[model samples]
Target: MQRPAYLHASYRYGFWWLALVALGLLALGLGLRDPWPADEPRFALNSLEMLKTGHFWLPHRGGELYPDKPPIFMWATAASIAITGSVRLGFLLPSLIAALGTLALVTDLTNRLYGRRIALLSGIALLSTVQFALQAKTAQIDMLVTLWITLGAYGLMRHALLGPARGWWYLGCAAMGLGIITKGVGFLPLLMLPAWALLAWRGKATPLRLKELGLGLALILGVAALWVVPMALITTFGDEPGMAAYRDNILFKQTGKRLATAWHHVKPWHYYIVSVLPWAWLPLVLGLPWVVPSWWHRLRRLDARVLLPLSGTLLVVVFFSLSPGKRGVYMLPTSPLLVLAMAPLLPGLLCKRGLHWLATGLLALLGAIFLVAGVLGAAGLPALTELAAKYDVTPWVWWMLLGVAAAGLLVWLRPRRGMLGLAAWLAVFWALWSTFGYQQLDQTRSPRDMMQRVVQITGPSAWLAQPDFDEEFLLQAQQPSVHFGFHTDQDAQFLRAFDWLTQAPGERWMLIPQRKEDQIACADLSQVNDLGLQNNEHWWLIPGTAFASCQGDASAAPLFVAPTTVADAATAGYQPATQQDQDGVTATPEDSGK
Candidate 1:
């Protein structure tokens, strides 16, 4: 079974080209845009708050403890921001670095197990997959956690299949501990142990002693304690109001309860297998027809290399699937191992004409769709124009789309090299989207424009309060603003906001979501200024005068939590709304245009 000369050449030099393409695609959009929700802004803000308040152990969002997950990712983001001095640059660095790290580990491990050609193909497969590329470009915890898990798997695999390499096993355990701190699911690599145990039972692999397992467990706990123990102590004994709740919620609720009785993002057990794999694992999914058969053959011969990663991947899928809650990203930890399992077969499968044509057809279809959409958008097609209007982006975005489409089509012309062409098309698509697309959509995706307008209407001297505010809104606020609470009910938030508004009528304003406008019984709606739509929600600005028509309840005192810099608050002469200003105006006309 002699590999072709061209294949060997590719194996020798393919890694560098893969690295270059990855760097260009993933890092191209760094610092060009603000973090877009539903997760990016929240994490970015967490990091920013960490840097601002010097509270790295307990993450906060809008001045309140954010216990939904541990602070490892935030710590990484904060460190990046501290070094780079730019949130936009710092926020995405961890994910980008993690992605590269994952790639290197997958490639190197695959090389050791299957040789260089399979390794190169493995890296290419990972980079070209929709899930991997999407998560790499996203500033989410999933990708960073994925890196840690992959490192753990790499070390464990090295020890299990390659040797009784104690050092590598310990490294894997430590990495998994780090992963746990990054996200709760970091211990996922431990699932690989079952396959290893199966091999041991069959007299095919080295058995880990009870002492070795205990020590590995110790290492994992020891690594996680680097953050957890300190956090637990602080939150337990600290004078902070919500520290106890934060500790319990994070330690128990977010981990075990979140997994078992999961409240949100619920889906059927087959969600990942059906909805996710079809598209998210693209190009890789296309190769499964060949990979499954090869894997089965290898398994029948009791090949430990094939058994370890394949079993681990399936175990992870089943682990997440059994849970009532699911998200496409939750299945991310399985990708690296899955790709490794498929790597050995990719060399043979890729040479098949059917696979080549499939690759070519996919690229062509994608290219044609984008090219036609771009042309129509540029010509002011109603549907495209409406979409642009909805996002509040200029038609220039379509021109950029046209350029990307043209570039992709150019690559697709080489039908013989369809897989390579497909990879090339993806690189072009990511690079353009990261740069031009990021800039074009930043204004609409972010709350910068809306917050700037809020500051303008309220004046520099006026303090602002936002009730039921989102993370992006608070992140972008120029004024020294206060939020009621992130999880507070809308009615309670409005009541407290009304009470706060009456305290300093002329010097303070309230920003409320338009959807919740009906909840403000104390405020005069006619005097509520419209702040227009931002982040797909209309916002209304309420002057102090808007609340003068009703009497405030003494019980509804404001719970002002300020997330903005204290120095900025001081510079703006912003005081807590509890400090009433006697000499304040009672009425002012609503000026929506302002």
Candidate 2:
């Protein structure tokens, strides 16, 4: 009972091109829509400042030195700001463009190497990958970084396998360099495919001409230097040594020492292995036996092209496995490499009637998961929505996701339609992110808004101290001039001694705010204030003597007394400080300012 041989070759290729285009659009939409965590907005704001000030060096966030990472992500956003006149969208565009571009590249390259049906399945798999799609819209540089890395690896592999082509070499050089600029260091992992291609084949190394190699290398270095040299010059002279420290620690430490620098970047070795399940899902587990069987057969026969992609994927996975610090994104570039490696065989796995049931089952599981995403969105986001009322559109996005998941379940249940089921599910999942989730980003206040709130609370004369960093993060919202901690709030020298006292000589107003568990910094504000309220993560405002008069009783007796920097003249103009104001906390200025 042999099935017709035509089934393998007869996959409808014409619509897959359209599918790729749809995926690209979906990716772009996803990227543009989700602002996600504060980190992404912070990147966007920094880049916006770079564009506005025309100064690429100093990232004056919240009106101070913003020292962290090379400004590659910022530089990227500057281009978007120029075109769109909106920093928000500009910040997200790189990831969106990178994601969609990667899809097109995968479809085009894999189709050329494998077949139309393979191209379709690979494109759907990579693009629809639940986590991957979500990450594309995030503000982080990882998505674009992965795109360049994938391209670089693919290009280098092509040159190695097909003999040295001038274009392939040049593209390899350029893509690798862009990959470096995106995240700094670790570019070698991205080149794993090409390296594996060379290593898997036992013959003499295919040599590139010194002239061409040098030329390509120069182009790569030139593009990288465009961003790096400026950062070096500025950090050498900036008030903050943070950027300089990062440069020395990350670029110089190369791999190990810097892993200890930040918690967000820190994790156990098995972190990636634990995370691979969500990214690869059930299909990877099901396809494992088939993958190795083919691999063992091909390797015994010494097939360079077949070995190249597999080796590349393995190299990256094994390399990241050894890193002390492993975030989910560390293996991002590996996604395309692995997808491309398995592309030729994966479709056959999907096409099989018995084996294909696993794919359907996986789709059903995803449907159940997304159905939960819908419920959580409707249930969980209201608290965030109540606090962040501007995100009115966010709740609908969740419901829409649920609806799409329901639709996907219908598509997935049909007979022999795994490919189409993948597309429908991805569409609904991403569609929720693009139109509904993206709208929530606008609810946040920029540095400008934050500064205004601080000003409205404290008078012009009060010193606005930052107990943590330079307070650059808050300033990136594009607010007017708010003095640095030294000028507006308590200077560093007085922050420790009797900070919560009603009045301290040079201290104008205490703005020390408390923080959450996952905050980047830690401070014991016990000496500063018993202020019952908190901010971003830590540090409470120290109440000065003057606040008591301001907080007496709001209804004519006096609203509430507020702590002040100087006991002499009380600041005026706003309603008296009270324990129960619009923000819903029951801490009057007197309660925590001590």
Candidate 3:
């Protein structure tokens, strides 16, 4: 069958329209809310502290060296915050830019490998995936790392499959190096080499040259040294107590040991295969039945385009699966390559009636679920009512879900355009979730309001210490705060906090989460003031008097790192706690218990 001229022209221009739509979808609610928990606030706090302390090389969180991850993502975030002068506005910029960059790279690579039509479809497919959109809107390292990995793959594929272009290969190596600095998994794109070698063996691709390979390896090393050499030099010679540990931790435990002898987030090896991909990949995964067969057929024909990306993605999945530790976001870097491999088959597969119905049915099913949940929630059903009370969400959230349900079902009801309707429904879901949903859930998900209440209860002059605190609390704290350490043992943190509180009984206070109240051996939980629920945890504000009966741990000295700059307090609309007030205040033992 021949395609018409108008359809051809539409295919040529479709990606631009998709790009604009993606920009709006990914960037709709930029500055409307504070960073939420789990990872966002941690990264945002790292970026803010970087700007405050002017420590660009080694990132810190709550005034302690953060050694879990490299600082490239934080560096980008700090640069964004520096330029915008607002964490709310700048924190998510890196992910947004990286997401857009990934889309552009995928589109261009697919265009070169396939054609304009496949390229457009690939972009649309990548944009439509749940994980891609979610990561794009998040202030996390995964999205930025994915961009670098995609760029690496793009460069490698271009030179290996399309040409003997040395520049592109070197560019790819450099990108992989940058990815390594951004996240430990950035070297993932190099997995494509085995597939490239297979292509070369099949006489379908150029053989690797030793000199070029050595130079490319050198490029990767050189780019990584940009951060590595300086960090090593400073930490090795620096008088800072923890610098050596930070050096060793970031270089070893956080990388190889963390991977091989994984301590956290452990799941069975089939976790991704069984649990994550089916949902995380979304509309793309829905087509895998057809995609898999087509891919096999292409592989049989020794098509380098299909073989390279497919093998790279499989190798990445296998690479992570071998590790005891697994997170779904660890698979993010594989998405662009997966989509590229799927691009050539997508046009025909998308047109299949079964796939269309499946996509539309999924959309309809989601709409029904939302509609039912909203209706039940509005009717004060016990499950929904308990959920609302637990999360402190309002009735309007239910109403908003109803709206999303209505919008999605309406699109699904459209005739013979199931794929288009599915796309529309996804667009509505993300747009609403980012803007309306963000505003509605911000109070509960974020610690901003909770911190405000703390400040109100304790007064502006009070010096606060959070023991075993989440980053969101510290980021949103309106008072100048001290923390024992982020990774310190909970009981040890409380012991240190108790000692610190006794130093200035009248002026000092401790904030503790209910989950960790067991660690407060010295404090009377009854005397602790409840600060209601925030971020799914009950926080207590304990006046120094609450710990007055504590046995002294005078020898237990904790690292008392105060914010280098309390400008964030000003930004939060409170005066920074004065050092004089914190240090000069002294109360007699009798007055302390008052």
- Per-candidate TM equals 0.91, 0.70, 0.92
For every model in order, what is the number of clashing pairs?
Answer: 0, 43, 0
Q: Write candidate 1's Cα lDDT for 395-414 as tens digits.
A: 45555564566455556455
lDDT of 3 by residue, 140-206 (tens): 9999999989998888888888988778999989998998888877788788888788898888887
Best by lDDT: 3
User: How many backbone clashes are present in model 2?
Assistant: 43
Candidate numbers, best TM-score first, in rank order: 3, 1, 2
Candidates ranked by lDDT: 3, 1, 2
TM-score of model number 3: 0.92
Taking every candidate in turn, the Cα RMSD to the unseen true structure, in Å, is 7.1, 10.5, 6.5
lDDT comparison, 1 vs 2, better candidate: 1
Q: Which stretch of 10 consecutive residues in model 3 shows the poorest summed lDDT?
A: 572-581
What stretches of model 3 exceed 4 Å from their correct place? 1-9, 395-415, 564-594
User: All models: lDDT?
Assistant: 0.79, 0.54, 0.80
Model 1 quality (TM-score): 0.91
Better of 2 and 3 by lDDT: 3
RMSD score of candidate 1 (Å): 7.1
lDDT of 2 at 67: 46
Quality of model 2 by C-alpha lDDT: 0.54
